[model samples]
Target: MAKRARPGMRRKAIVLRDIDPPGTLATNLFRAVYNPVVQAWASGAERIIAAYAATVSEMTTDAPADVRAEIDGAAEQINRLVLLLTPDLRRWALSVEGYVRGRWRGAVLSATGVDLQTVIGPEDARQTLANYVEWNANLVADVSAQAKQRIGNAVFSGLSQRKPAREVAKDIREAVSMSRARSVRIASHQLSSLSGELARERRREAGLEVFAWHHSRKAHPRQDHVVRDGKLYTENPALVGKKVDGIEVRAAPPADDRAGVKPFCGCRERAVMVFEFDD
Candidate 1:
């Protein structure tokens, strides 16, 4: 006779659809909070880039020291811009926290019929906010670093190739322009990821039994996520904590090492409700 399946060993698949479908809640919330901050950052980044471009445009000779000094000076300006935007970034973070908290509470209630506030308590909310603050700080730091690297590369490459000042200026302009676009995309993606993570946490805390990875058809489907899409995993301590494709689905911060939730990734998580047991 075939061996019997262990208790909770065979997961019954459950499809947890996105609470806020793409371009609906995710896009709207992200734009509402992120647009103003990103616009400010873009404005500051452009000014810095323009200054660097002007310096390069005026360069009569490709002196490495002079080029390096100009690049360093530009990096300082970018750092200052990041500092100037800290208040706005903090506001954006708070907005995200509020949005995620509400969505998570609603999703848990809808899936399990349990009020998340009653089960998870205020401590969980505080922890969630703490995580958001850390995540936001890291994001701002990354933007600063990217700006420096991008500007530095433009200056170094143009000078190395001895490109004409006007051409170098053009390249810098293009780089800065691209950065603005990328910033918006990144902000949107991170908002989606944050929501997925918080919702999963709330569901787990509310004693849900299963969880599913919701793949984005709009995203370039990765084999890892594609294979796992819509499939369910038990929320038992052993299984939920187990790594699949280098991602612990129930991880507090949501695993970032994978393509689905990595920077600019648009994947979401769906909390699966199994009625076999009652909480």
Candidate 2:
């Protein structure tokens, strides 16, 4: 038998749709910067990669220094790319915040007969979230930086082995592709994690003690989280060990294993307003 959602429980999906657009835009922005830059490295006679390859063909030791300089330049370019994406990422996070605030306010009022005051109010949380957006945006930048390093190493190693410019270009393209994929993952994870964290704080502030485990009904859901769906748990027990389903005590979920948190499971919490209102 299915347990119907109790009062104050909002399906996390209502806000899940808000997670993807900015991530998509971030990916597109990254690709715009990543693809052309990498392509320029290996193209025409004057191309950076072509020039480096030519030096190696001529058996010149000076090629290493020149290529190193180019590598450093590429790294700086990757750093600057973060500036372009940060604004959009911050806006996306704030949009998620707006939706979560709306969802939480409506749910709490409907269930508790009291309008809950936000403990994690925007005044306190805004700067923190902005910093979070900056941090996550840097994550995308880091991927590109790492990709640049790989391209440098691959080009030098390949040329020394007498590999063609086209071969080195292949490796460079693969690195760019990998970096783009990682940027997408970082964006998606940041949005979902931010949403869940903000919601968790709101629940705590409202004095909600128990919450239903809501499995993300996305394709290929994790089985453990799926099993937890509709069950109740409390993070109120010192924010560490928790009471699961009101039947057994369990440790707080490990940081990496946090249900519906980022970089892993997407499961979310549906706070249950079990408080008695003094009318």
Candidate 3:
């Protein structure tokens, strides 16, 4: 933590090369969001299976009509499942966005020894946060769409194959699990991306044009991102190869050009404010 600053005075910047991400918070949010959704999905899967089994005793081998109608209804259950969970997602999005913003502010304060709230007023903060609203919406939409598609595919493919009720139920269970895992990944990635964006905007406003690159150091990190660790970057990357303080942009450029960083990249821009002349 940075020391308390007196009114009308600024504290010296901390010599920190790596200001870590809000990993704990991110993980907690993932569980908070994933667990309930998975449970609900599990229940929905059960309902789907139940639909197919309602007339199980009447079913005979190659009863194609029963499989088609019953399993189609099963697919519809997934649609309802998405609708059932969407309201909760809206609430989750709002809360997670606020939490990520708070974490980003804390990271800035710790790295630069400046109070972000003091520098970034309430209106500016709200406006900056508001600009990223679409990201949250994307979370909701993508989850819903993917869930429906994956489960629908499982149901339809099983129907086409004329698989037994038990086998179809198995397929649905696997699909629900797959959907949950994919949703978790999307949630975690978006949080990382959002925090990275917040860091860039807030740091630049605080006269922090240069930043120390922080590699997440997670398992199986990208080769390029690993090489970027502990280096410095400017907003302008037109000169990627130019060395400043021995920064060599030999690593491959990010695939996404929108933010000068790629989604799920896990790297962060820690504000590096130079406070005094070198001896």
Candidate 4:
């Protein structure tokens, strides 16, 4: 005979299953920013690569000075390209911040049915937006600097090897291609992390009692052990004197490693709402 399930257990299962997971806002924003930056970088890199390839044969040990100058010039051009793109990158950061902020506000409302504007003042929202914008801007600048360094190193190594001009040019092109792929991965991971952090912060401000970790289901094996599906945690454990406004929430023990906080993590957090009065 089939056994009947307990009413309380059934309701708990439904609530867990009904919780909304994090969206793809971060990935989308990463792609939006990465595409244009890569396109522009490719265009500039081609010009630099071509110029080097044309003059590579002139870089013999006897005429090393001219070759060195050419390499330096290429590096200078890469830096200049990054500088030229800064303003546009900053603009994109601001746009992404605004979009993420809106999503944060909406997520809080959906979870607790309380508008963030009513709980947290407008000034706090603006400050949060500003923080996200600054974070993205810094990420862009860091990626750009890393790219320039990689290109410079490739050029130096190729020229130093006294290889044929065409071969050296090929090396530089390959380096740039690898760097482009890496930068996209890095940017995507960082953006997702930022999104998760913002969501957690807004939920806390909205007075949500507990937050659950939501895995992407597509996460690698290493991340699977960090937090099981539907696991929850308290926002502050040290505040013993603080008044508790909601039911005590608990979950599996915290992981020893910071898997979800690292780069390339796809995990997100969901606010676990506990209502004082039944709806």
- In order of appearance, the predictions have TM-scores of 0.66, 0.72, 0.69, 0.68
In Å, residue 168's CA in model 1 sits off its true spot by 0.7
Report the lDDT of model 1 for residue 67. Answer: 55
Question: Which candidate number maximizes lDDT?
Answer: 2
lDDT of 4 by residue, 1-279 (tens): 001223233222112122222345444545555445555556656665665565565655545455456545655554555555555545544554555557665654553354555544335456555665666556655655565566566666766675666666676667667766876676666566555555655556655555566665663644454545555556456422232233234542354222245667666666655432122
- Model 3: which residue pairs collide? none
| lDDT by residue (tens digit), candidate 1, 23-121 | 444455345543443444455545545554555566656445555665566566556655565555555555555666666667545544545455444
**Candidate 2 C-alpha lDDT tens digits along 1-279:** 012225564432111112222345434444543344334333321345665667667767787677667767766765665567666666666766766777776665554445545443565458657776777666666666677777777777876787777777677677666765665665566656777777776766655565666777879887887877766566556533443334332344566666557464567777664433112
lDDT of 3 at 86: 47
TM-score head-to-head 1 vs 4, winner: 4
Runs of candidate 4 with Cα error greater than 4 angstroms are: 1-41, 60-63, 77-132, 219-221, 224-226, 238-260, 276-279
Q: Write the per-residue lDDT of candidate 3 for residues 155-273, one digit (tens) a residue.
A: 55765565677887887788778867776776677667665665565566656555666777789878777867777566655534555444443333353722324656677767665
User: What clash pairs does model 1 have?
Assistant: none
Model 3 off-target regions past 4 Å? 1-19, 31-37, 54-116, 236-263, 275-279
Q: After superposition, how far is residue 178 of candidate 4 from its true place, in Å?
A: 1.3
Which model is ahead, 2 or 3, in terms of TM-score? 2
